[model samples]
Target: MKKLLIMAALIFAAHFAYAQSENIEEIQQFIISDVRYNKADVTPIYLDAKAYISLYRVKDEETIYMANVWPAKRSQSYGYIYDLKQTSVDATDDTYKNETLTFKWSYKNDFDNKQGTATIKLGLVYKPTGIAFLMTMITEDLNVTEFKGYVSGSLNLK
Candidate 1:
């Protein structure tokens, strides 16, 4: 009976580990189309750009990659590419309601070496046909931004 119990515990631990890894792997690359920047004593500015974002695992660590974004525009067609290291994540498994995933990251600007923390909250809107995500990111500089777009894939809320 002791051997059987040990085997069961091992299986449970393995399954839990697999689930945790799969949670980060299931996120698909999605476009962050709309960006709303809110700063102090100023009206919010909205930028309609074709920025892309993706979450993936690298060397057993999860990374957040954001491409073609603001602060990098040279002419009329491009922007800076940056990646943030995933510091923490919390996910809810219940699918009956809107599933929310909160991801936090610590990033350092490569050009200036200034360090900051950012938190991204993604809400998966439950619908019948297509899946939509609304993400809000708050940075360490107290800049609040909102990103809205439709995603082709879903996040594993576990």
Candidate 2:
């Protein structure tokens, strides 16, 4: 009976170790795509432009970052920054009380199902009670065709 108990303990420990995934690291440049608001079409917009941009972890377990956008900063196409024309946040302390982030992008095709690609930043804010990542994305796409939507993808956390 003692041998049986010891064997069971060893097995349980091994299984527990395998059940946990690796901890996510401080990513420098993470990219994601497939940002849609509806589930109409599954085609990728900005097929030529890579999304997800770069990321920075200010608080390790919780962080946000951006890099690599469609129209770089000088192209007059698209760009991102800690500050922009749309820093509409309710932040009273001055640091964007976490309102709307400049991480905004969109695509739509009313004539023939406009596909959109948006790269919104995600932040994992560590609070006192628990850890959570929060980020916002703006979507004002009017669905005219079969599927008008928005979607976002993130890097594999582990």
Candidate 3:
């Protein structure tokens, strides 16, 4: 009886493993380093865990749009990823108050134990314009934060 019960439990666990999500879960585990920007140079914003920049802009000096990344699908390719959406933000300045990007996430990856961040982060210089790029870097422990959005909207997988 004990052997049969153990086998059953193993089968149940295997079922769950096989039932794993076919899509890369969108998790809220990204972070950004608060920095001061001007209408001139691109800022050195920190990537959360995938060598990625949460947000950046050359002229705004405030607010960043972080690209929430994930695998394109259940593929074995190492470069199959997608930018679900972006979280719009307003950087804190003496001229204005800092606004948090309203994000809605439903995935989780406790990646804080290792060092991973997004690379080659870029954005518009002043919204709906030229591309402002930021060379992304990584050097911290953080969770994989999915979901990016702005004050009046949200980014997610439907």
Candidate 4:
């Protein structure tokens, strides 16, 4: 009887592990598009770029790190890392089914001689046809200029 119980426990554990892995993969497959940026009193910049952005959860989903790399200049790449402060998943709503992630981060760009702080609010809304994303960034002290941008994307996560 003990051996049978042990085998059952092992089977349940394996199933749980597999489910967790699948969930992680779904979170990693978010596709970013329709990127745009605007600074205070400056012209808006539209980006013709596509990239796969992923969020890594650590410490049993208590900490989440979002990291993505994409092209910036002719031969340069720009990367952004955000540590999430709050997260919520709402799948019951009929209209706005989304997972919302909020973050506040501060960094120093020595090359640009700027100490910047940013508050990012991102949401992945699930539609009947596809997944849509909305992201807003509010930044300060970037080249001594405050900036804000609203960007939208289609997430191709299954």
Candidate 5:
């Protein structure tokens, strides 16, 4: 009787662990598509070009956030793996039924022997049919040749 009870408990624990892992996989697969940069400029020059950015939630001791931005022209790309400090969603005052998702992310990057810490604010709006996103980055060690206007684009969930 004792062995049977222990076996049942172990089976139940395994099932629960599997279910939690599946949920994490679903969250990791969430994708944002059709993103383009409308305005921006960071050194290496090509970083300013329009691009598509994808976000990923990596499973670590704590969840690790990461993003990959590939230029629309396919010339250059940037990778950001960081900690997502906070996120908030709220209804927007637009006629077209939309909600805004805002995220505050922080990361460290290295460029030409110089390392810098970056704080990025990403705002995404879910439109009636599609989505739109805007991002701004502030860095301590990277030079921004052109940082006027804004980085704006459209996003589609994949």
Candidate 6:
């Protein structure tokens, strides 16, 4: 009877562990459609460019990737991957209905080697028939950029 009870407990523990890991495997990608640059001159320029970004959150480790989508002549379009210093997620039970997530990080580009703090906010919403997603990035002493688009999971932006 003792051996049988131990075996049953082990089985239950394994099942619970598997359920927890499934949530952590989710990765979301965002395609930037329009970029609004808020210049220091109080004039904002809107550029309709093709860019890609991704976010992956797992406990103390979160990654943000900004893809370089210019020139169209580079060997690789994948840009820098920054380690986020702070992250916050405010989500509802139905994430597609309404949700918001924010990420903060400091980065230094290889071009000028200047450090700056970057904060990105992701707004997600769901309509009766479709979904809507928007992302905005703000940096210190730099232009604030806004991206209007949706993700591949529910909405398509072209």
Which candidate comes out best when scored by lDDT?
6
* Candidate 3 wrong stretches, greater than 4 Å: 27-100, 103-158
Residue 126, candidate 3: C-alpha displacement in angstroms:
13
Q: How much is 65 displaced in model 2, in angstroms?
A: 8.4
Candidate 6's residue-wise lDDT over 53-82, tens digit each? 555454444544443333233111333345
Name the TM-score of candidate 5: 0.42
**lDDT (10s digit) by residue, model 4, range 17-57:** 68865655223444554444553333223233333345555
Question: Could you tell me the C-alpha RMSD of candidate 6 in Å?
Answer: 14.8
CA shift of 77, model 6, Å = 10
Over 94-117, each residue of candidate 5 has an lDDT whose tens digit, in order, gives: 544333333434542322333345
Model 6: colliding residue pairs: none
For all predicted structures, in order, the TM-scores are: 0.50, 0.26, 0.22, 0.45, 0.42, 0.50
> In model 5, which regions exceed 4 Å deviation?
1-50, 71-89, 92-114, 142-158
- Candidate 4 residues lying further than 4 Å off, grouped into runs, are 1-29, 39-52, 57-63, 71-94, 106-115, 142-158
Sort by lDDT, best first: what order?
6, 1, 4, 5, 2, 3
Worst 10 residues of 3 by lDDT: 73-82
lDDT of each: 0.54, 0.39, 0.31, 0.51, 0.44, 0.55
Model 1 TM-score? 0.50
Residue 65 C-alpha lDDT in model 5: 49
Q: Which 10-residue window of candidate 1 scores lowest in summed lDDT?
A: 72-81
lDDT of 3 by residue, 1-158 (tens): 99999999999988876665332342322323332222322223222222332332224234333333322321111221224344344534432322222222222233332223333222322222212332222213432222222211222324
Q: How far in Å is the alpha carbon of 59 misplaced in model 5?
A: 3.8
Pairs of residues clashing in candidate 1: none
